[model samples]
Target chain A: SQQGEEDPQALSIQEGENATMNCSYKTSINNLQWYRQNSGRGLVHLILIRSNEREKHSGRLRVTLDTSKKSSSLLITASRAADTASYFCATPRGKLIFGQGTTLQVKP
Target chain B: EPEVTQTPSHQVTQMGQEVILRCVPISNHLYFYWYRQILGQKVEFLVSFYNNEISEKSEIFDDQFSVERPDGSNFTLKIRSTKLEDSAMYFCASSEDSPNGYTFGSGTRLTVV
Candidate 1:
């Protein structure tokens, strides 16, 4: 399976705290993207980091990619209760292959 | 903001029956894709469509699965014969460029009995 593996299957943090999730993939990739899913809802694109780039930031979200390590990390600064969701990392080869995802919980 | 739209948010069907999941991708986007997540499993790619033809497909998309853009706006996935294992959340996504970020629809939850 070319699917990426996300570390720390579940995370809990208080409001105003930062939440971080890591993803590791097995093969070379063109780009890696992070998405958030709230409960039964569909995925929302958060950010995308290319293999050639090391880091990118969008709003309160920060993403880092390490091609040498075949891994990427997503950080949410000062997370809010609304930020609670399942976060997935996807690597697009021919089609996007998604990780099992990290479920995040932010307590208000 | 433009978004991918899918119809019939949830459907309950019997095994061996045929089911068609429909989606309307963002206008001007040339790439379309279908993916499914079975309960708690990771999302798995089913197929990708471009230029009105399938560009790539996963092993899971066997003879039973087919994708078609019958018109200019509608992209559909037809399952010839649904199985109990076919119960999953099907998501439709589209991208203007390959390997770029894609906008995904809310998804259709199919419950096969």
Candidate 2:
């Protein structure tokens, strides 16, 4: 499959804890993007890390990419109940191919 | 903040019927794309349009699928004849340029009964 694969299919954490999800792809990519989606809703773009960049941070969200490993990770620090969502990692080379997604459950 | 908007959050149609999913991408964006995700499946790229033409499309996008900007705004995806397999959430997205992040619409839930 020409798709990125995500690890730990699911993650559960308590409020104030940290959550991390990993994504691995088979091919080289120009950039990798992270998105969050509530059940049955459209996806919300969280962040994007280019091939040249190693890490990026947006408020509480942090993303790290390792081109050598063809993998990336998204970290949500001090997670909140509202942060509970299915997080997907996508590799965009012309078009974006998404992974099965990691369901993050933040318990209050 | 601006958002990508899709219409008819849910649509139910008979198999073999035609359905058009509409999306209004964020203004000032130059590229548009359509993607679909079946229940419990990963999101799959369908097609990408730019400069009034299709810049790229996937193998899944056969003759049955078509996309058009039809107007200045409104980017649309039309399934000529829907099938049971066509039941999925169709998402519309836009990006400013190459390697930029995409803004996606909530998606139009298409149910082929």
TM-score of chain A of each: 0.97, 0.96
Among these predicted structures, which one has the highest TM-score? 1
Identify the candidate with maximal lDDT.
Answer: 1
Query: After superposing candidate 1, which stretches have Cα over 4 Å from the reference?
Result: none
Tell me the TM-score of each prediction against the true structure.
0.97, 0.96
lDDT of 1 by residue, B27-108 (tens): 9999999999999989999999988889999899999999989899999999999999999999999999877969999999
Report the number of backbone clashes for model 1: 0
Model 2, first chain, TM-score of 0.96
Q: Which residue pairs in candidate 2 have backbone atoms (N, alpha carbon, C) closer than 3 angstroms, thus clashing?
A: A42-B106
Q: DockQ for model 1? A: 0.88
Model 1 chain B poorest 10 in a row by lDDT: B94-103
| Candidate 1, A43-70: lDDT as tens digits | 9999989888999999999999999999
